[model samples]
Target chain A: MHFHVEVRNLCKDYPGKRALIDVSFGVERGEIFALIGPNGAGKTTLLRILDLLDEPSSGTVLFRGAEVDYSIKDRKDLRRGIGMVFQRTVLFNMSTFDNVAYGLKVRGMSEREIREGVKAALELVRLQGFEGRNALALSGGEAQRVALAQALAIEPELLLLDEPTANLDPRNASIIEEVLSRVNREGKTTIIMSTHNVFQAENLAHRIALLNEGKIERIGAFQDIFERPHRFLSEFARLENVFSGFSKATPEGTSIIDVGNGLHIEAAFERSGSVIVHIPPEDIILSTRPIVSSARNTLEGLVVQISDLGSIVKLKVRSNRDFTAQITKRSFNDMKIGLNSKVFLAFKASSVKMI
Target chain B: MESPFIEEVLSITLLSLRVSGLAVLIGALAGVPIGTILGFKRFRGKRTLMRLMDVALRSFVNTLMGLPPVVVGLVVYLLLSSSGPLGPLRLLYTPTAMILTQLIMVTPIIIGVTMSAVGGVEESIREKALSLGASNWQATWMVLREARMGLLTAIIVAFGAAISEVGGIMMAGGNIRWFTRTLTTAIVTEVELGNFALAISLGIILLTMAFAINLLLTIMQLRGVRG
Candidate 1:
């Protein structure tokens, strides 16, 4: 498969700080590739470099197997094929129609064509009847949609979105995500978006690259990365029930880990010796009382802290080692669990995976 | 009712408006583009050498902004006086010489204010324009459009300065009655002759014209802001 863009050995340094260090990645043609990491992970920096809005301190960005020439004429020509939606929606101080028409006008499109293209693009984002409104007067969500329509009106070959829904409400975020997916599917536009939201990446991207501290820690399909994550990836993705312990093989072909403080976690994996273990937050069950169940590992712990994460409650339990478990708010109310409550955490052996 | 004094005031006022209006028109024609270019374009050594040049240029223009009109009159008088460098053309003590003096005074104001106005446009707007596939010229045009209010203010201010100035036009125009006598020079002539009533009447007319011009520009400015 021909790669749409190949970024090789990219490095960006700003005064006393390095934003991107030896970052290298290839974007497949017509695929939704996501750069996932926390804030200040150099996501914006990388996207800026890809968009040719910025030049890297040292690197070569190959567009369709051709190294980009960093000349004024060449860069302008290259930028014409790429559309970027900034983390902040930047709309021209004009009517929505004019903002959407700006790119086409710059490209020297005829007025009739500009009108048709803008109408279609606005319709794609479900922003019809908004053309006459001032772009600056719209709500945050509507403004963002207009920005997206502006980019799409150009019909660029590559779309680079830098946290398009960063400050948006859930409904607006979902709308943007749906539009992105539809654009990719219908227009076959190559997409590369940088997002701090892990769930959004998992939902939208066909492939994901986990970036941390200016480096790509791992890149793979969402299921594959989640199933067998690196230590840093698991931490960044908030698959946070991670532990380090020595493992010994059991007679049943399973391995038992002697976690510190007299805690033993059994896993179905065959790994032995020193290993990093990850337990998905949803896989662990929090109970008010010990239950006699078929699940292999059951540990007794005190609920040291409970954090309300919107629809769910994240409980930090202090067993032999600290373990974080996520439970529905309704479940928390039903179980009547709170701070300092003694609880039993149960998970099957297969739920514990070694990284 | 049809007094010669009133006729004299009308001619003086019309000549003053004509000279100053032409001066501002020419100044804006020359200054706005130069100011816009200086405001937006970045070149090598812009942070150091170009910045130093920018400071020097602004200092020069600002110094000229406050230039005493008599000193400008002296310079123009020497240049256009008979037996001077431009003596053969004999532009001295004429309406053309007065227009030239006022033009010199007004150009710096136009350039300084326009440069500041164009510079005040947000850098991000230019970047966004460029990212949207606009050429350098196109981006610049957009910035200028965004800064229209400041440009208009520059023109208004420069015109005001030109219309009210007396010393430069007095020396260059020679204040010949019925020919080169503008409102300002005429008021000076009347005051020197102890014609306080005529002087006061011309003063009122001058003040009214200034107010009328400012009121019109202010209305346009407010409309632009509302839009």
Candidate 2:
């Protein structure tokens, strides 16, 4: 059997944490493979290892039936054939044309070739006229599209992505998803991506690996992995900002859910007793300080994590419970929010959806 | 406009610029590379030693940045004295000695500031470059390019500190009337002699230089520097 990439008994230990343990998988050539898991479930670590950016503590990774030699001095040649986009958007402080042209320039391409390549890549991402715009000044969606252009400009044999659309607005997310599908179909590039969203996985992958707590819980078709464990896996793994608990209907024509851990979420729908609810990250707003708002849900949270997604900033705020919020990068800077800074999250009751 | 006093002031200002400018130029040439190395490299597989060395280097640079002007002057003066190790070169009590003194004083400022600039952009930029197929040297070059503005800030700050210094140049240059005199030492002399008008005028010239350079810096910042 011919396989594009295969791993056996991979393990990675960092200080007191074991990020991956004896994980084994094989990806066939020209197929979309996905690694789906919740937060802190080793998805990022596995992707990094696959990109050859990090070394496993033990195990062997074979690419194209040859074992990878991490100790080789010419790993540049090996890595040149692979492209990766990180979860947090990263771009050079340069014009979009220059940022997208970086990989080609590093490979000693001629000026004409680099220019043509950049134009084509940006056009692919629907950023035809953004060549002269400063990358840092672009909106979040545009900046992420620029990042995708940078990766696609390289035309790698393998593409790896970490949470590509997890924090994007719906339109931009769908655009990226469409681009991924087109690239896979047209270029026949082997793609590996890690995501916690079941909807995204179900929409893209031909094969799936469900990872949790440093190990693969299951690996197969989506339905094959979740056939029996559907309720348990979907509770926390399928969506962003998901909560489950007993809910009581209020006189204001809404439902208040006691999601435990000193938190109660208000939903627009009227439901009683056991229930599950989800709030899309894009539906929430973040502020450095609290303000009077008509929204039914207002919670003060501590900024635990901040991800710069070009024009937008995605923050993980630990309040009554962990909540994800998105805000414009300008507001994030204006508010001078930093890690551990107190902030507020306000979302309309209608923003919550029953799962 | 061609008065003797005005001619003297012009000469002093020219001397100050020549000496301090040369010193800062040499400092940048030497300090930028050192700062880049310090910013980008770590001793992998030896985390404890890496941290210890990092702390030691930071403390050393901080101490040098805060070193007394007179102390630097004394050290340079002694090194070029007749009986010292560098005595055979006979550079004592010359503009060269003042340049050396200012170079010692400002190189740490340049190194410290440049280190911070390069360090700020190092990790994310390097990883991004490497993941896009750049080699190690190419990745470091990318970080340095990204930090071009910070590097400019370093040069501006170092030049400001070097030009305004008096005690070090006074000791090393000996404030020779037509030979080694600079704007700062001349101002000190004018103030001691109660020439308030000349002293104030010289102060105005110093402020004007700082203001012009800082205006350039402000414009660069307003050009939309994100990091």
Candidate 3:
């Protein structure tokens, strides 16, 4: 797909900090593009410039082959077509209905059109009976949804969400993600969201761009960036996608063993006795007892702690070796596991892949 | 000893009301816009303008607050005399002279209070208005609407100052009975004539007028708080 945005050599300077430096990228039309970076990585600054809230110090931002100029005489008309949801929920202190209808009023729409548009947009966000309620009375999640509803009411050509799920709970986060997907599919509005949550970007974004030091370090499809990340970028990215280490060496020949821990299990793959062991956390399993099972590896351990995470439960088990296991809540309930429960873990030999 | 001086005091009090009320009306119209502009707009000389206003108003108010009524009368005698530059206006010994001096005396107070009120509007509110695509002028009016209660307080304060003052009116109005003799001037003249009963009655009326102005101001401030 051809790009809807063509940013060339964008630069911005503020006092002692260079907010953006020769940044260049093009976002394909209709793609859910996520700009991911750490704090102070200029993500907000760049988004503000793109939204025309702030003027860039230099460079060109071509939206559909035209440069954006916030200082132009016709800038208000330009801003009317672009929708922005700030990180903080900027709902009016008025009724929920007024918050959604404000954009239409500013755009000079008729009263009938405003009423219909606000109703339709509110229904789209599933906030149908909330028009009469005060926006300040809403919960954080509801407030954010109202902000989304306000933006969607404009029927914008492009949507800019600044850390939309930054402070939401997991359930609310999922709801926002679902709402974004629905809008993108139904409206075909081009979206550019900035976030620090890599997992959210991985899951929702069609393309992810890694921003570092006010520059674009890598840009590609979600899995492509995750699987074959740049050497410099992967070092930091791998911190969140942790992997266990394993290796082995024996007399017959050299061989690498994928042990479930960072210990060298004696195996037939490596020559002369020196090696290491590696394990990925997802491969581990937990049980309440020793079972006569066909799996080669079965570790006996006491459950150190049980943590409940809505859909998944994490069991920190300390066997002769310490390891972690993730299982479903139903499985946890079936085993009736509690604090400090003795358990056996099983995984196939093939589950342990040599690195 | 308490003769029926109520009717005499009422007329004098009404005279004071007409002159001071007119002065306050003029002061409010001139002062509010100046204060609003100073409060919201940034210019190269804004701090200097604010400081100048501060020094000039404070000095004038303090000087007027202490000046003896007879001394002001003598000064007006000189200003409206044949040699004074304003003598051509023939405003000497007239109610217009009293109103003009009182207008000048109360304008700074109104302006100063209004400046502080406009300054108190939250910056976040202004930024939100700008982001909403309101022109700067529209945003300014919105901020003024938010600060209207405080500005109203300033106007009331100026009115109170005009009504309670005796020095400027006595000097310029010449305490002309039935024409320019306001409440404070009448009380002073009654006291000079050894009619303690009538003088005390006029004093009571002056006190009541001041109390009423203050009461209205208090009520307005309370409403502002509730809002």
Which candidate gets the maximum lDDT versus the true structure? 1
Top-down TM-score ranking: 1, 2, 3
Look at candidate 1 and give me any clashing residue pairs.
none
Docking class of 2: acceptable
Ranking by lDDT: 1, 2, 3
Candidate topping TM-score: 1
Who is ahead in TM-score, 1 or 3?
A: 1
Residues A258-305 of candidate 2 have per-residue lDDT tens digits of 999988889899989998777777789787768579888999989898
Chain A, candidate 3, TM-score of: 0.76
Q: What would the per-residue lDDT of candidate 1 be over residues A95-203, giving only the tens digit for each residue? A: 8999999999999999899999999999988999998887889999889998898889999889999999988875677778889988899889999999876666776
Ranked by lDDT, the better of candidates 1 and 3 is 1
Tell me, by DockQ, which candidate is best.
1
The 10 consecutive residues of candidate 1 chain B with the worst lDDT sum are B38-47
Taking all chains together, each candidate's TM-score versus the true structure is: 0.79, 0.78, 0.69
**Model 2, residue B10: C-alpha shift (Å):** 3.7
Flag regions of model 3 displaced more than 4 Å: A132-138, A228-355, B1-124, B139-227
Residues B101-126 of candidate 2: C-alpha lDDT, one tens digit per residue: 99999999888888888878848678
Put down candidate 3 lDDT per residue, B152-171, tens digits, no spaces: 88877788778888877887
User: Interface RMSDs of all predictions?
Assistant: 2.1, 2.3, 3.8
lDDT of 3 by residue, A25-52 (tens): 8886677989888777788888877777
lDDT tens readout by residue for model 1, B1-227: 57996787788889999999999999999989877876764521436777888778778888988889899999999999998999999899899999999999998889889988988887767777877888878887878877889999999999999999999999999999888999999888889999998889889999999999999999998766533
Q: Which stretches of candidate 2 lie over 4 Å from their true place?
A: A230-232, A239-355, B1-8, B41-46, B216-227
